[model samples]
Target chain A: MTMRSLTGTGMTEDGMDELLAQFLVEAPELAQQLAEALLALERMPGPGQALDAAFRHAHTLKGSVQLFDLPPLAGLLHAAEDLLGALRAGDRAPDAAALDALMAAAGAVEGWIMGLARDGAGIGLPAEAAALGARHEAALRALLDGPAVPAAAEPAAALAWLPALLAEAADPLAEARSGSQPVTALHYRPAADCFFLGDDPFGLLRRLPGLIALRVTPRAAWDLESFDPFACNLDFAALSTAAPEALRQHMRFVADQVEWAGVAAAEPPASPTVAATRDPGQRLLRVEAARIDGMMDMVAELVVAKTGLAGLAREAGGPATPLGRSLAARGAEIDRLVAGLHRAVLGLRLVPLAQAFRRLPRLARELSAQLGKPVALQIEGEEVEADKSVVDALAEPLLHLLRNALDHGVEPPEARRAAGKSEAGRITLSARRQGDQIQVTLEDDGAGLDTAKLRRVAGERGLLPPAELDALDEAAAMALIFRAGFSTAAAVTGISGRGVGMDAVRAAIEALGGRVSVASRPGQGTSFRLTLPRATVITRVVLLRLGEARFGVPIEAVAETLRLPEAAITRLAEGEAFVLRGRALPLLRLSDLLGLPAAPAGTERRILVTAGPAPCGIAVDGFAERLDVMLRPMGGLLAGLPGALGTALLGDGVVLVVLDLDELAGGAAAPLPEAALS
Target chain B: MSIALEDGRLRLAGDCGVEEAETFLSMLQQHPGLAVDLAEVAALHTALLQVLLAFRPPLAAAPGEPGLARLLLPLLGR
Candidate 1:
């Protein structure tokens, strides 16, 4: 038991930090490039330069995985390299199955890299990861030892199976074809004694992706009187949105028993990552994102230091003297230099939204199959750049919106045609740089929100009273869907309609200093536009004193501050309220909110009004200077405390607790439950 | 017995194994309108589930388990 504690030894060992950090930075880029190389190889008639490059990248990745002492990941990577080596040696052609194995192996390594980034050397790879690694390794090894990737099936054999599956799964396959993109049809028959061998064939069939249709039939006519329950006598066939290559990869181990038919040529992958890999800057140096952030913090320090020197020159000899004038000139020079350096470092933090768009293509494919409404996603301005933190945080909200577009907005094929619209739906995602802000637009050409329906659902769910529903205008009524617990899904799906609805998406965008709005034209489409800061540069925070401690509140959240006479504040039964502009506004004492002792009776203090939902006045003892500083998110022992955004450092090296006005005003005074972190 | 008759419904709770399939089949045959409830089951063996699939008995309650529902829902014509 004590030996498990010794695992910390890996982190503290000299030089491991730099080594692990470098590994984290280089591995993901390398894996990305390798995936591109594999894609090229898959599309080629015969491998050439791409195969050699892929082999080299796989070799490099395996070495990097081994450096972190992750043997299982290394082993999986090694098998993939071995298969690539065989292809290079002309021992085997690069078949779809082998390429599938290699691509999946690369994806698996990417996941491992993420875990390592989160926990560093303290992470022991999960048992599930090890099992997945073993399976990938086994499949690759078998490919190396077995015959070449199976040949394309005969046309006559396909005819025998295709009609049966369609007939069996008629309803499921009806809306499956929205356009000419392509569909993969498969027939899989397990061994006769598979059940005795502990293989539930139906279980594997159930896991198929985009499984629009599936049918099970007895291989030989079932003789009920003589039937044996334990004997596996069934044949399974399915139709899916998965591509032919993906289907081959999924059924790799059972390839001999499976037959793939009716597969159209696959469309070129529309992933931004694939385009990013072909980038001309392949030789660009890789640097860790954290190191670039640290540089930004240092730039802030230099600016502060330069400002302090100006005050010193005044005390020494007023600005007219030679010493004072020379000091002033030097300070001006330093200021110019610092501004240039700031821009250069901030440039390092600007990453294209491309990386965030990688999973989008796969998402659209799966959704198309599930809803039986084909959606074509047109992405524009992926080259638009934003702060790396902003790029990363926007992924989930964007995914939720995309899911919502497909799940509820898009109509089934027949319905769209009946409405005099195109059979296939189109979703356009566009990004642009608007001065200091980035505007992202998601527009789907589908059935737009029905304002009347929205109002009815809101009233039916008791989220609003009949009077309020009747009084609201169309825009406000449409916005009701953003309220938590509001859902229009006829039945809950595991995707967009899961309990976490549009409200979570709005909260996330707002937390990043962004605003989201929705507009729709009934029968035309629905569009969502989100405007976010290009970067949250140098947070301007107003410092206030609470019980001998100073806390910072983001200046954007503070509406105004005033020194009020004792006669102004009125006591109410609930707590306190102040009359402002002929209206009553709630007032909460900072000390009371933080659960600290009350101020002495008749002590004079200033009031800070917050400019958001539940507009309120917060009374605190006093206020200090408003300054721009780098805010670091809460970590270690201070982590998970309610209403805490992060911390900023003051000149005296004191930590100024930054408050999230939204969390505080919303009244979540307790720490978040542990389960919410995941 | 993992398959217990409760009120008019057969409650398939906990783990129902292969040995229980015959008794389940007998119960289905005897009660023409028999429905199975899976709200409390933890791990249901394939043989017992196969019986339910073959008979297409009305489900009083679907399994609280997601994997069970995900695997068997489409097959039950839902």
Candidate 2:
């Protein structure tokens, strides 16, 4: 097998490089989140968790990229970090236009990361970085400058300090003494929310590099009137002769908040210094996954061999056979130990869900911006774990849902305000496990679907009859959004007016063995919920037999399996029907759907009544086997055949096609008639 | 410095690659080897695993960090 094929999915030869790539993947998302949060803060004028979340995510990306020495990305994040830091400190939050600039800068940095990943080395980005720096400085200048400074002068003033500072700051004397010096400084401060971020103030202070001298001064000796130990009010001063650039680099993320001064001397001032050090001799020893797989194969062989030996020993049973008994016991223990080790080895490949969730806020915000709507997004259950490839595949379609919500579900500011709602709409995005499946829900509280408009659109498109459109209630009308060419927007916008988006979303969700459903109200907003299995390695299916042919049904949709007595099923005009628990369900036989022969006479029929929220049932001849196996979807002509979701290989080597129960049972429109059933 | 073989021990000298595997294996085939040194190897990849698996040789590992050893353990199981 090719090395790429053997290592399983998403394992990179260089983990740090992969992590750097992931950082790029995550940064754009964080930038987008900050924009949305800024919008929310502007509209609601209250402190919400989204801003803090956006800040933390950006901080995390900044930290990860810093480890890789990606200076430009680090610099952009540093500016954003400063803005968020100031906002967190109770300064007036950034305005809309400033937030828009930051969002664009965020996009640029993300694009840079992607560029770096695609190419092994990053391009010389000095010009682009300087331009972004100028833009950020201009915004900061505008924020700090009052009406006294004309708005256009803010950019000129921000640029004014650069040349003089750059030229005068270059000191050759200091550079000569240090052998080649750039800059150096010492910064000291008590950490903000140190207790919450999980750090001990004194311990962190003690660990500072290049400690020329250190002293911690207690802010309050404890007045009985007010003394909060948890509220750390301590400050420290340190004199470090490390290069100011080194000091600044170390303190980059928190540079703005901390107080620091440049050290004029090249050497330390009579204090111990921990010089920065790294051993470049280190190398990553690579291993082939197939070798591990081969080892596992041998272990399996050993298990089988031991089993045979134990069986032989049992067959030759005798009380005096202590050696045989000992061998058997030892073999059993070895088998258990090997199995445990195998599971641990497999677990090393699992990655956290944060990698996926980290990108959503930015995407949500960007989509909202492009569609010209205000959306406040709240993401929960971000700590869920899954395989990395699955997470990568999830980004595009989830992003599409975000765009769909902003483009279609959310009403504009005037519409929301007129409906007695806050001008900024809310989108709550969450994921949690329901049974064996992960359920991701994207919900928006905007102007919900107008059933009348949906009816008119459906009638005009000739997708649904005017009578049928009239019959559809709010929930059913919203379902039309998933139909191909079913957009409700009056004019084509960049985001979703083409009408081809949601159909693709449906296909993508279903392709992953998941189902997507929409629920909406006229004035209350809309929600799209998707449920998918945790892993695609092995699929669990419910097997049904028709004549000699047996097919599999996904267990997710099988509500209940039953042995239907003849009296329970009642026939209706042009079709069969069954009344169960006060609801009339239309019955379609699996044999008829598959064009298979009928079952023999005098045999009791077994029917599996499958339905989702919309109840229906399918009658089949007999119950066969429910098996778990590796599933591969049939390609070419067989894939287009009605009702088959995918096919799996049964242990007996027979190929069983898995039926999509919802598509088959939800409607009475059978593609094949009894004449076609042979 | 690159990886080399000495006294039945695989001494990893200047980071050499799998193109040299045949010569190393032929030498090993003539004299069954055990110990291996990774001191000189700057990096290793899947090709080394393929070589080790091809020979099914038990490795008597020289000094290295646990991470290096852990990465090689599966292939060494052969």
Candidate 3:
């Protein structure tokens, strides 16, 4: 009989690729933790939990780093691990310089992690950077100044696994005796926290050429209630025809977990299979977004197919007929199942906002160091969940907001004392889920936006005329920061004012069908709030008709829909205007926006009012049912069409183009917003 | 549901991941006499396998993957 592939999961199973992918995802998190924890430990005195955690992160990082071919990275981590071990052992007192060196090492590793993500081996990182790792190693080693103190993990006692494995694969073992290769036996009990360290038990064995027999068993009984899907719980025992050195070399990463019972000839045996042993695990599986998106596409197709099944069934026979009834029942079952499947597939794409928040603390540390402005960043509700795409897209805008806070909104430590505020400025990044939306706000305690300066900047930059700038209220003036080419900073720093303005940040958030608004009270500092959908695939859109052509716009973009009398709308040379809530709101005819003939006039005009960077209203003929649709971004020749969000396939077999309200609300060439309040 | 008990026959299809293990166990415990059908199971996670090992429900059909079936059938004493 053919031996099992030994590669767990067997689907495109390049064990190295999977392990590297896992490492790339997990290591940066470790690096961030290592930096943050050490930085915290330095500020706090005595041996506390953070010290232990710092050591654990460093030790865990080293374990994963040593397995790869990058000697410099591995060496630097090795030295850091030893220093941490010494600190944990109370062999030496923790000092700021040592902590600083360790933090620098963490920073280097964090940088290398990005390069590692691009390529499993070395990416095109500069040679000096790799050499810098060695230098960090030398610096850390000098700080360490002793024989490495190895914090060996206690060996897992797995006596029953081998005998069970031998019993299960006894026949394969006897059959393999005829083979010439020197067989070796090993009981690989991976560290319980291996998954956290990116260790795949069977993945480590993928390199072993010959696997005559194998068996997987749990290290302990499964506790039904406490089963952690992220923790590594399985013990793998295998008999391979490969030499002991080769087996040991491949298992080097997890050398502690393995008990080498050499010479398989002396033993009674185990071809292999996958997924023999595992803990329900503590960590979530990192799936490529493309995989889930592909599944979503299939599920969408299923949705379309299932919608027509009843019609086809009714055509075959009347609903009263047994055949028709059976078909209808089957169709109903498919509907429920498809709906459940859709939810499940969407759930796979739901990642905690922590994914976006993890990197920001490191950024705060770096920026705080760079500016010499002591700022305390407090993040709350990071456990809030959002779609992977949405969470991934959030980092850019969030980073910019944070940088803007530290650089501009937050006052320097001495300056804060002069303002009677605490010496250390506080910036809070809070997130919360509100119905179908996730609102993330970054608030900083610094000299708040100077509306006077904002208006002056607006006037000088030609973003708006001085008359219009003066007409804006305090809140309206604060919103000018998001206007194209608006920056109040007198001098450009390496951070927020690096050519890209707040307008880019606004665009990024709006492109995701989200809203970004700023609020400030001069000396109290600024708060930027971003309201984004919890998921991207199934966006809620209001379907409306303009001159017989139906269109859809994301509901989040439409602040409110109203009916206005023709007398309310006064025609201007630029376009049209209507007064609402004591403010002049620019109104655009939807037909005119889409270049279609105007809708026949009615006593009352149906208007879709949007709250965006430039608030405006679009007049439409009629409104239809709001739907949650899978929005496919414009492709082929239709790409980059302004005001078009994407297309959605309706149940009636029509493709509805969802409008990008923000883009439509603020296009220079578009008829919209020329008469806008400016 | 990837793991379903229909008419006392528990069926697992496609890829049975660890996420389903908790429900699979509860269902196994709830219906003690439910036989299993892994005929369409493309891949089985270790958590589900351990649960199967603990329960040892009678098999309605051998696993679809030959390699998996070979190792699992005997362990289940089928």
Candidate 4:
């Protein structure tokens, strides 16, 4: 249940090294856990559990630092232990003051650990680290000397006798109520080089608040003669009834790297304790990711089979037949069961969005600082969940947009103040879900896109005619920013305004089955909202026919499908245009966009119109059917076609090309012959 | 947070603002051994002051003799 498993185990060199490496890796994670726990504790101050976590964290940090004579690390850790010790005593509560100091000290210790890990360097504490320690040490001296803090003294005594008493508790209710209860299990793995960082994992765990159990095992076992004392290869796990939160806070300095999770009452794990094992380093289970993947693959097959059965049952004559009725009923039941299982299987791939959110602040800060503008990035909705694939593809474009906002949307601090804004411009990055889509919006408070400047830049980039730039509406003009090689910056800097352009950002999002739109006011800040499909499994498309070929058009791009009379068609200098209620709409035949043979249009052909800065109509030979289907991207040479999103294999086994309206709407820069296009 | 020096320690009490923490941390530079009194401290914000404390002074910049430097280096040095 705790470190007791390794009690009699002889330590080995290799085991010790592995244990130390694990600790080095876990320290930062523990620190992060502490931060989160402390934040939670502030919200729910009555939780005794937070105090316990703080104690454990400090206990671990202190213990690990002791093995090596890393004097500086030990001193700070010792101070943190004392402070957390006071809080656990219940005589002194963890107020914001103590928490801040504790967190700061933890961070310092983390830096020290990191420094040592990088090289065999000594932790050089900042003046404040020493000052803070002095402060905590003074407080600790006061508390240790004062009347016995009940919780602190109780743990000391209870831990001393907990092991013998917990084994003797016969009844569950009695066990729960007993002061000797083991409420938690702690796992500690100190890196082989832990001693170099002045960390002693064993000593730290030994000082835990309610040490009902303790054990030390090497990361890997080796002959005792070859056991390297300098190599911190031991890992320790302990069980105690002390609150988890307090233990977390006590070890917040290296919070980013440790992993901590609660142990269920039923999963004590029968591993030999530190004092019990002959060779404490041996591990019993090592589950490979590939094996889990194999299990998931089998589950997926079961789902597909269940779907087939349901389909077969629907085709059966009637439920009146006894066999048919039973089969149908079972089929329906299996459908529901498989659906639930499918969700659970898919859930395994969902990860918290916080993984990406953490990297944003520093990025925002750096861009803002580089631009001589003060921009604060406000991130929210971090708990939103998305598949790992989506999260992985999101990082870069988000960074690009952040850079774009700083480079173009925000003004210098002085400029901001002159415009009646705060010196620090605000850039907010937020994610929200609507239906089955996730929208990530980046908004800034600087002067919105300089339309005139954009127009000038567009003209310079040859994206627009200088003479007609003034005639273009704001939305249409703003869209120019997405054009390739577009840059409004007076001069290119290391950050942005390069040829990569917003087109790159648009391309990135589109690659993930998403679309990006910009909304802004001339003097107000601009907002870029990228709406992405939650997953790539299924796409919603409006199916239409061009002669004998059926094509799919994404629902997002289709504003409406109108059955227009031939009279609506009007000829323009550039090409054939259509007018519906006096608005001039450019028309691009679906056949022409797909490079398919143009079919003779019927008197009443359906025109699918798109919505954006520019609306375009695509005339199909006939209207087929609209269905949402799974679209597999076309590979090889066909992937380069901008107009084609992908292709789907329909139930009839016919391959239908999916149209990318956004790309088609980009208009003809180097148009092929009108006849050849179709 | 209310911070002042008492008995050679930087005595801190009351709720500490992140912005003000920076100023308080700067004060510690002149008085490195300043001890803080959190007994009456109501709140502490993990801002510039905390970050400053957490920021280990580079060993290359550590003062020659062992005093506060000695106390702090081991906690932060590699």
Q: Which candidate is the best by TM-score?
A: 3
A646, model 2: CA deviation in Å? 4.3
Error of 2 at A322 (Å): 22
DockQ of prediction 1:
0.08
Model 4: per-residue Cα lDDT over A147-220, one tens digit each: 43334323233133233222322122123322334466445555556555655454455456655544433456
Model 2 residue runs over 4 Å out of place are A1-103, A118-352, A386-390, A471-473, A540-626, A631-678, B1-78
Ranking by TM-score: 3, 1, 2, 4
lDDT tens readout by residue for model 1, A256-322: 8898876432223322223443354657776767788789778877655666767767876858798
lDDT of 2 by residue, A1-678 (tens): 232321224545587456545555455555445444454444433233445655676687677666655455677777776666655554544556545655665566666655554453334343566676566645644553222212221223322222222222223222333343323334345563454554443434334554334433344453323323344454445444466566667656556545655433332111011011111124633344466545544443443344455555566563358866776777678667755654454344344444565566666666766766777776544444554444555677788787778877888889998999998889877666555567778889977777778778888989877777787777777788777677777887777655566767876667656688987877898888987655444456777877777788878778888777777766655677666676666677776776677666444457787757665667787776565454544445674555667766554446678888776654454323333212
True contacts kept of 3: 0.00
Q: Give one digit per residue, the lDDT tens place, for model 3 in A1-678.
A: 011211223345367556766777778777877776776676553355467768888899888876555667778888898888887776666777678888888888878876666554435344676679878988888887644335444234445455457556645654454343566778887777765575555544533557766667667786756546556667778888876787778888778778876543422000111011111145646567788888987776677667578777888795878888888889889989988897888788887786687678778878998999988887655657888878888998898899999999899888899999998888988777888899999999899989888888898889887887888999999899998788878998888888878988887776676789999888898899999988756667899988678899889888899989999898877778887786677778777777789866889899888866567888899897677677765656765466887787777778889998667666632334433543
Provide the TM-score for each candidate, comma-separated: 0.58, 0.47, 0.60, 0.45
lDDT of 4: 0.59
Cα deviation of A669, candidate 1, in Å: 17
- For model 3, the local distance difference test gives 0.74
Which parts of model 4 have CA positions greater than 4 angstroms off? A1-342, A464-472, A522-524, A540-592, A595-628, A631-641, A644-657, A665-678, B1-78
The DockQ assigned to candidate 2 is 0.01
